[model samples]
Every structure is written in structure tokens, then in C-alpha cells.
Target: MIPPRFAVTEDQIAAVVAEFYTCVRQHPGLGPVFAAHVQDWPAHEAKITRFWKNAILFDRGYDGNPLAVHRAAGDVRIPMFDVWLGLFDSVLRRELPSETAAAWSALVHRIGRGLVFGLGQAEGAPPSLR
Candidate 1:
């Protein structure tokens, strides 16, 4: 596995996930959308923490498909991703060191874009073509 891009611990990642979801739950635009899908906040936070760990630390602890999940939600609009990223950026900047925040922000934005593209083309073509 690749080394981490910056010096960040699992605890830091989990802390960010927890705080970010707290913001998401309180956000007017994001709250309703997420509330529909998330019933157990702590469990969701734990899952997302694993997702970030697997992404940044290559921990291989996360096993969920974000594209399919968002697509299945049917209400996950592309525009909403922009808002989500913005909120996430805010959280990162507030919670991490500048360099770490920038690195993580870049990663998440890339992930967000991929999810948007995947969601957009999901109905247009088969997985083989996409």
C-alpha cells in the first residue's frame, strides 16, 4: 500500500468524519437529503471514517460502493455534490493542518467528481461502456 500523503492519524480522520457529519446533520440543504438515508448517525460516521482511512491510508477497511449507493438514492443531484464538497472543505480547513487539509480536500473533490460523473452516466450506458 502507498504511504499517507501527509502525517495524519486514524483518530484525526475519525474526528473529522464525526464533526463533518454533525455539520451535515445541521445543514439545511444537506440535512434532509442525508436524513433519508442515514438512520444511525454513529454507524454512518464510523463507516465514513473507514472510507477515508481506506482512501488516504490504504487501510482496506472500507467496502462500500459510493457511486451505486448515491445512484440508488435517486435524489442525489449533481448540484448537491457541490454543496457537499463545499461543506467538506470547510470541515477540513477547520479540522486539519493547512497542508493536510489541502491534500485531503483535493482527494475528496476528485472523489466527488467521479461520483458525479458516474451518477450522470449510470442511466446512459452499461458499466462496460462507462
Candidate 2:
């Protein structure tokens, strides 16, 4: 395993994941999109937490292709990426320190852009770090 990118902790990552999903489930735009695919909230959150840990901490615990996952979801709209990232960025801001939030938001936005691009979304740009 590689060293973490910054000073964030597992607890922090888990909290953010949980908080983000809580908000996602309530979001008018993103809620239905997620509810259609996510049947087990706990398991999904655990998986996503591991995915983030692998990305942010270099733990190498996650074993899935996010782009493929999103592609397979089919109903995921191009505009959803911006909404998702905006929601995630908001969670980061509320859940983490300024420096750590900015760093993670940068990574999240990069990944969001990749998924949007991989999905053949030709219009609308990913939002910048806020």
C-alpha cells in the first residue's frame, strides 16, 4: 500500500461517504437515479468508502471500474455529473477542513470529469474546485 495523499482519516472518509449518500437520497435530481440502482445502502456506502480510501489513501482495497459502473447504469444523464459533483463538493466542505476538502474535491472533480467523458457526454463542463 502507498502512503495517503494527505492527512485525512478513515473515519473522515466514512463520515463523508455517509453524509453524501444521505444527501443524495434526498436530492430531487440525484435521488431517483441512485435509488433505482442502489438497493443496499450500507453495502453501497461501504464499497464507496473503500473506493475513496483506495483513491485518496492509496490503500488499494477497492476493485471495480467506476467508469464502467456508471456506463452500465444507463439512465445516468450527462447533467447528473455536475449535480453529483456539486453535491459531493458541498459535503466535502461541510465535513472536512478547508485544505483537505479542497484537495479531495480536486480529485473528485477529476474523476467526475473522467466518468462524464467516458460516458460520451459532449456538453457541459465539470465544475471547478470551489
Candidate 3:
């Protein structure tokens, strides 16, 4: 059987990121955390855009180590992952078609799990195993 395909354009992804960050900046729980880490919004948004472009479109524009970056940020907590994912899901659902949102949410969920594990935030496993 052929795999399902979702057509996600770069413009749509950019709009999602932009709208998501706007929500993040206003969120009471997440806003302060992101504000502490992100000094310049435009630069951070550009970097994130490159990251999504690379991950979703195979654009090869992003090269930074996200795990290392998150680790260096020094403020990400385990429960924050849930908040981030929830916000991301809401924005994606609002901005994209259902199939496209599902596809992107799945990918982001995997990435969030890995990040949570990598940052030593997961409950059961040591960082080495993760």
C-alpha cells in the first residue's frame, strides 16, 4: 500500500511558525520561558523557519544541534514539553488542513519526545540511554 502524502507548502509552514510564536509569546506558562531564551524574535524565527524547512522539505538549510541548543538554554522542564506540543498542535490545526496538521504534529511529536529525552527530562531513562 502506498503511504499517505500531505502537501505542505513553505508558505504554510512559515505562517504556522509565525502564528505559533505569536501565541507562545502570549502564553503565561511558556511565554516567560521562551522570552528568557530568545533574545531576538526575528532571528530566532528565521532559524526556526530554516529548521522546519529542512525537516519538512529536505531543504538542508539548518545545521545547528537542537539538543545542544536546548541543553544550553538550561531552563526547559519536563512538563513544558506538553505545553509546547499542545500549543503547536492548536496552531497547526488552525493554520493547515487536517491531514497536513496531523503529519506535522506527528513529526513534531517525535522530535519533542527526543528533545525531552535528550534534555534529561524524561522520567524513566538516563540521558545515556536516551
Top TM-score: which candidate number? 1
Better of 2 and 3 by TM-score: 2
Candidates ranked by lDDT:
2, 1, 3
Full-model lDDT for every candidate: 0.91, 0.91, 0.88
lDDT of 1 by residue, 45-70 (tens): 99999999999998998999988889
Off by over 4 Å in 1: 124-130
TM-score of 3: 0.88
Q: Compared with the true structure, what per-residue lDDT tens digits does model 3 show for residues 16-95?
A: 98999999999999999999989999989989999998888877779899988888777878789999999999999999
lDDT over C-alpha atoms for residue 115 of model 1: 91
Compared with the true structure, the alpha-carbon lDDT of candidate 1 equals 0.91
Model 1 TM-score relative to the real fold: 0.93
Clashes of 1: 0
Q: How far is candidate 2 from the true structure (C-alpha RMSD, Å)?
A: 5.2
